[model samples]
Target: MSTITTIGFDADDTLWQNEQFFRQTEKHFATLLAEHAGGHDIEARLLEAERRNLAHYGFGIKGFTLSMIETALELSGGKVPPNVIREILDVGREMLSHPVETLPHVRETLEELAGAYRLVLITKGDLFDQERKLAQSGLGELFDAVEIVSDKTAATYQRIFTCHGDGPGRSMMVGNSLKSDVVPAIQAGGWGVYVPHDLTWVLEHADEPTAAPRFRRLEHLGELSALIERLGREG
Candidate 1:
């Protein structure tokens, strides 16, 4: 086994619950749209709106707002009320103001890892929202590099490797998201360590946990030191 060097992290649900808030807000928005937008099916419209927004706004609250507006107009058959936009924007901004609570053992694990490996945050979302969370978390200095992306795919990880000049031998990814953190990180030639969260989104699921040497997992960040020690001893 190769000794790991750089350690990458995923933001959002990995650090603290993020998707739950989005899910909540979406439900609220859907209800509002149903009433105001004239009986439009909330779930279907939301999916359509998200698909359209992904193409137009990429990812972020700005695009979300746009999608809300588009959905209202389309569903209402051009009967969108002015206040509808305000309501959605208010929700989006509220998302910005959402409380910042770090995950359990996150700080301690980070403190430990900081001494052993170069830390970087690689997350995908609206640039503005992601940046705000990063700033508010007060975790900026802990990460040697910070990457805000629109999406994380197999290609995204490899690109991150190139961007940061980190090869598999010297790099690892420790995060809660398996889809975004585990598979892509390994496919990109970096080791991945998953930390399962009590509350997590469904989108990050993987078919199965990646196997040893290339992949590892911990229930909490507290176990990180031991995992690293085991890997080190094997190497």
Candidate 2:
């Protein structure tokens, strides 16, 4: 409620339909390896592979596709057919080409807030894929600035908010991930708003921010305007 002036948003589940595509791709991948391993077993191995590959390839479709391939190879003991590899690549291509569907009330909420505050897109992912999503989303112009970073941390939030000339105290971050968007933002001295998504990547999970006075939780993006208005009044 400290007269929040600059607002930041995470792009993936907060604004658009991202995780669904990945989930679909993962399902298809598991089916392809059904002969080699059980669907659930393949899924478990894929998750482990993705976690292990994070440090090496970072995030996004490219890294995920590679992990799926590696998992397939491991599950099949290197006997996986060439055709299966081609299908895996095809799944990645399908994911990359999936339409960017904005979540309910995202545009309306952004439109309401755009004129009153400095709005920034503070998402972390691969450069090319993130950029592609931004371009496809058609909501890019609503953001005053866009940041497609490699990672999200307290220091990262502090630096971004500070560079925006507002510092973290007067800034706020809204998104679905408690780990990447809320906790780090609050730790950096900014207000953090959680807009829960129906689907979240396992790696992005974190405990709710009950200890932070500036933390706010909303059911959806549409409620953001009212929350901000109330915070402003409190300020």
Candidate 3:
């Protein structure tokens, strides 16, 4: 069965817990707001601002910070005290400059799997931020190809697999989300494996598939290499 030659992976929550960091930052923001703002107005404003800004600016610390600033300006009605706005900006900047803390088993598993497989990383986010995380996590060196996509759909998966090769069923996709990672790959005629994430954003959570049965869920990345090896052997 040795059909698979390339294995695709989704970054962020799949490789590491991305949503946890943001959630931590959000907590800090809420704390800052409660201290400076009248009540929880800062928190509320930030939420509303995020909802509004998801369009103009996608994900990443930069967009998040910009939204925080926008929220501050609006909440203050242009009368925002300098200290309050500065505090928000400072927090946002800190998040941007923060180091990447990858989830457990990420580095070790990649080290083991990269040797036998053609690894590819497929992530969706602000190009710069995604690249920064990749570089920082030290996982970038393992992948033969790195793709920072704006979106992942069934069509997108087809294009990727076709470009890689059509004959070898050796290609597999591993990720955290059911919607973007599993369904798309399965629909594209490939294996779709899910590694459940402890923390992920609302947007990252995807709707269940309506058609083909292309979903395999795993608790951790450590279990993936064996599955891939078995598939490789079977093929």
lDDT of 2 at 38: 89
Which number leads on lDDT?
Answer: 2
lDDT of each residue in 181-215, candidate 2, tens digit only: 99999999999999999899999999997978988
Clashing pairs in 1: 5-170
For model 1, the stretches where C-alpha displacement exceeds 4 angstroms are 36-40, 162-166, 198-205, 209-213
Q: Output the better candidate (1/2) by lDDT.
A: 2
lDDT of 1 by residue, 32-122 (tens): 7766543347656766777766866786667766777787788778876778778888998888889877777777778888856778899
Best by TM-score: 2
Per-candidate local distance difference test: 0.76, 0.91, 0.76
Lowest lDDT sum, 10 consecutive residues, model 1, at 35-44
- Tell me each candidate's TM-score: 0.86, 0.98, 0.83
Answer with 2 or 3, whichever has the higher lDDT. 2
* 105-184 per-residue lDDT for model 3 (tens digits): 88888888776777888888788778888888888889888877767887777777667545225478888888788887
As for TM-score, the candidate ahead, 1 or 3, is: 1
Candidate 3 C-alpha error for residue 154, in Å: 2.2
